[model samples]
Target: TLNKKLIEKSEELKQLSNDLSSANENLIIKDRQKDDFLDSVAHELRTPITAIRSAGEILADDDDIPLDIKREFLNNIITESDRLSEIINDILYLDKLQHGEIALNIHENNIIETYKKALSPILHLIQQKNIHISEVDLLNQYIFEYDEARMIQLFHNILGNALKFTDEQGTIQTKLSEKNDFLIIKVFNTGKNIPEEDLEMIFDKFYQSKNQNIIKPIGSGLGLAISKRLVEAHSGNIKAENSGLGVTFTITLPKKIINNNEVEQ
Candidate 1:
């Protein structure tokens, strides 16, 4: 009996030690991720700042510069300044969100209306490209519980991205349905297929794909990251995959979210 007791105690202690080591490793990984995030932010900010400073210096140093050329430089400064502001704002917002400084107000509402509102900001751009937009017709309403504003933000990020990457005259579609006790929303776009390896990492902060079909680099590369966080805040899931001719983003949200201020998955 004494020998059995000793063996049991030793086993428990070994398990406890292993658990502590695993937890310590997680902390180290998190710290490393924080360092990487800061480095990426600085790297992204540098481009616009450099462009703005160079354009300003040229405009100031060259007095005989033609009025038209000066106007062009001024435009460049304005554009780069806007870009810098966007990067800073996204970083601040994401940091607060990840740290739980902000709360989500989850409630019941007409999800379809929220979806339409998400499209309003980018509708003109879609029209400009002559892209076809469609929604899967639902016989009954999808009155699901979610943070209305956050859902709009989530959809805007995915839809706007599809618009940005899709070819002119391409097609964009959205479908909403219920699976088990969850609501599933999918956004599909016609564009170049994303590399298979990048499907999952696209949600990581500051991650950019090795292959980009567009001539100019897309937005701060933070849109999908924000989308992922927003979905998770509602106890939801979001993922992307390369489809037949393009990529599709699928978001799954619980139909019933029990929330005080924050949700847990």
Candidate 2:
């Protein structure tokens, strides 16, 4: 009886040892992932900082430079500084949202109006690209309870990406439809499609598509990641697909109607 009890105890100890080993392995993997994320953030910050510093130095040291050239350098410094601030703000906002520190102010709003608000901020870029937005399905009639600002950010990021990738004089199409209790929004741009492998990880943080043609110079590769988090926070889903003509991003949000005076979230 004593010998049998000792064997059982030894077996239990071996199982515990295996579990601890597995846990340690998992910790190692997560630690490496954290390190990689930090490294990317550092690089993103450093790029703009370096640009700003260089531009400032040129403006300060070149006393004999032409007035027009000096003005251009000053503009470059200001633009780079603004870019740096944007990156920092985005990173901080994402960190807060991930930690559940941000609260949603959900309300019933029209999707089309919100989309227009988002588009207004980037109209200059759109004009520069000579892109035409065609056939916007009337979404103003569809009312949904959600955080208006966050929804605008979501559409802004998606539309911005579409604008970045679509060729000059290309077309970007938006469509919205409701099926059962879900509202679906799709944005399609006519240009090079994303690589098949990237479609799977496109929403991942700091994940940049291997398709080089669409990568813009100023992107920190965090916009889609932030957009995905914001959508999920509102009990919705977002996805991307590579169509024959280009890429399409789709968002689905749940809809519920209660009494005439109220809407369920």
The lDDT per prediction is 0.87, 0.82
Which is the leading candidate under TM-score?
1
Model 2, runs deviating above 4 Å: 1-22, 256-265
Query: Model 2 lDDT vs. the true structure?
Result: 0.82
lDDT of 1 at 82: 90
TM-score of each: 0.91, 0.87
Error of 2 at 185 (Å): 0.7
| Candidate 1 residue-wise lDDT, 17-46, digit = tens | 999999999999999998999899989999
Most lDDT-accurate candidate? 1
Decoy 1 TM-score against native: 0.91
Worst 10 residues of 2 by lDDT: 256-265
Q: List candidate 1 segments past 4 Å from native.
A: 1-6, 138-140, 212-216, 263-265
Which pairs of residues collide in candidate 1?
none
